[model samples]
Target: MESETIQEPLDRFLVSVERKAFVMARMATRDTDEALDIVQDAMQALVEKYAGRPEAEWPPVFYRILNNRIRDWHRRQKIRNLWRGWLKPWSESNDRNDDPLEQIQDPGVVDPGEGMDRKASMARLEVALANLPLRQREAFLLRAWNGLDVASTAVAMGCSVGSVKTHYSRAIHTLRQFLEEYRP
Candidate 1:
């Protein structure tokens, strides 16, 4: 049998969970490149901020950074969309207008409807997850997918445990509603 020993436990821990984190990021962002970027940002944050902390605490801290980055990413997207919407009415003229804001596409954003390659169940689950409210998705994905405890989920989400529980409950309820007809 070949031994697969990672040098440090921290390295091993990060290696073990990185793929899941990427998946979580992908599910949140709905863009592979953006998801990869988010995961990279999260890794940088984890290394910078939490490297000195205990290894066991890394999960919560890493996810907290990741969740925060995801929030920031969404915020940036909203702002960009808002600007684009506001500018669209003015920029329809024949006058040449070159603005850097217009030139700057949101980083790592892929074209929409580019995920047609996913298998049926994965695609359905992606839609259901996407339909979830941000907080509900955060709660469910953190608690259910990441295997974080309620307290850890709260910490990652920057909310109270009660809020986490509420979001998770509502997420479960909503998901059941969404997927009820698809039961096999």
Candidate 2:
């Protein structure tokens, strides 16, 4: 008697994790459309690389690949910036004519029910977050937002547990300082 090996379980696991994976990519890129593309690419790579592996290995394997892809994307962006700097025209004006206030307004603040209405307050927090180095943001999001354990976050980040702890601690401290200053 021949028993068929079931692939259904692996397919189900992929489906379950896909949405969260997309959300993670979106946070890293801060763009929904780009995140969707990254997720699709990650899914295809996972199917090609790990679909034949044991179901137990799929989660970490898929995330490792996705993280590597995101890192590669960042590296390419940096290289492109360097090239743009070399090739950019000198004719462009350094002076800005646009109103800084227009760019500074937070739509989220307009609804006081949603949150505080202090424009400078929200801007301070956002600027603080943007200023954080990438690893810190990644660590904070993985641990605090995504609710991953330290060990799992370490695996996803391809870093030591201690490194993850350091990044998370710095991110939390920075965020706390920024938020405390803005507290109503």
Candidate 3:
């Protein structure tokens, strides 16, 4: 019975976070498969390692684990790219033809034109976010998208509060500049 009590909230928390976490990971990785794997790994790590913590502490702990996983993925990609460069220097191509925007849909929307406008705006935002430096992007997403406070964001990012503030401020400025034309 006691175990059931503990498991219930954790299950609820995971379910609540899963979609947002997947979106965050997808934005960071720009690869659907990689993002799914990262979110799954983060969820597993949180359940295995931090399940005993108070519910109030779960957000920071889970996000910290998720961000760490994303960072590790970036590191691994860098190493792979380095080796691939050495092995096939001439074949390197940065072009990606897939349009991720086409995959996004909102079935609940009643108007197709409004939905297209929304999707276009979201695509521009995503591109601006993708262009941000990793630390700035992490800070922005954790604070803005995840609704985490400054201290919680600091904890999630494994950075000082001041660093989180600085990164987030820079991210906001850069994003505002990038999306200026889209503004009404």
Candidate 4:
């Protein structure tokens, strides 16, 4: 009975965070499967390692685990890319046909133009986000998208609050420049 009480709020918390965490991971990885795997790993790590902590502490802890997982994934990718580059002469061309946009569902709106505009705007925002440096992107997503405050974002990012502010500011400036043409 005590275990059930503990598990219920944890489950709710995970559910509430799942989609945004997946989006954050997806933006970082640019691959759906990798993003899903990272989010799952983060969730499992949180449950296994931090379940006993106070509920108020969960967000920063969970995000910290998630960011660590993302960083590790990037490190592994870099190593893999290095090996692939070395083996390039013997390997076939690495062409991928998967278009991330194709996976988006129709909004089912009455006005076709509205949906198209929304998609175009989203595409522009995504491009801007993808162009940011990893640290900047992480700061922006954690602070702006995830709604984590500066101190919590610093904790999640494993960085100082000043660093988070600088990264997030740079990310916002860069994004604004990139998407300036789309502004109304």
Best candidate, TM-score:
3
Off by over 4 Å in 2: 1-7, 54-56, 89-105, 108-131
The residue-by-residue lDDT of candidate 2 on 1-184, one tens digit each, is 1112535765687788888778667656667887788888888898776677777667666777777777777787789877887898563545654532344445563546535555566666555655567788778867876677888788878899999999999999988886686565
Q: Whose lDDT is higher: candidate 3's or candidate 4's?
A: 3
Rank by lDDT (best first): 3, 4, 1, 2
Q: If scored against the real structure, what TM-score would every candidate get?
A: 0.76, 0.72, 0.85, 0.83
Off by over 4 Å in 4: 89-118, 181-184
How well is each residue in 1-184 modelled by candidate 4, as lDDT tens digits? 8667779999999999999989988988989999999999999999988988999899999999998999999999999988998978565544643453444445355457767677666777886786678899999998998899999999999999999999999999988886676553
Ten-residue stretch with the least lDDT total in model 2? 1-10
For candidate 1, the lDDT comes to 0.77
RMSD of 1: 9.5
Q: Report model 3's TM-score to 2 decimal places.
A: 0.85
Each model's C-alpha lDDT? Answer: 0.77, 0.73, 0.87, 0.86
- Model 4 poorest 10 in a row by lDDT: 96-105
Model 4: how far is 182 from its true place, Å? 6.4
Weakest lDDT window of 10 consecutive positions for candidate 1: 100-109
Query: For model 1, how does the per-residue alpha-carbon lDDT over 67-184 read when each residue is reduced to its tens digit?
Result: 8988999999999878987879676544765532233223342433444323433445567887678889989998998889999888889989999999999999988776664433
Error of 2 at 183 (Å): 3.2
Better of 2 and 3 by lDDT: 3
Q: What TM-score does candidate 4 reach?
A: 0.83
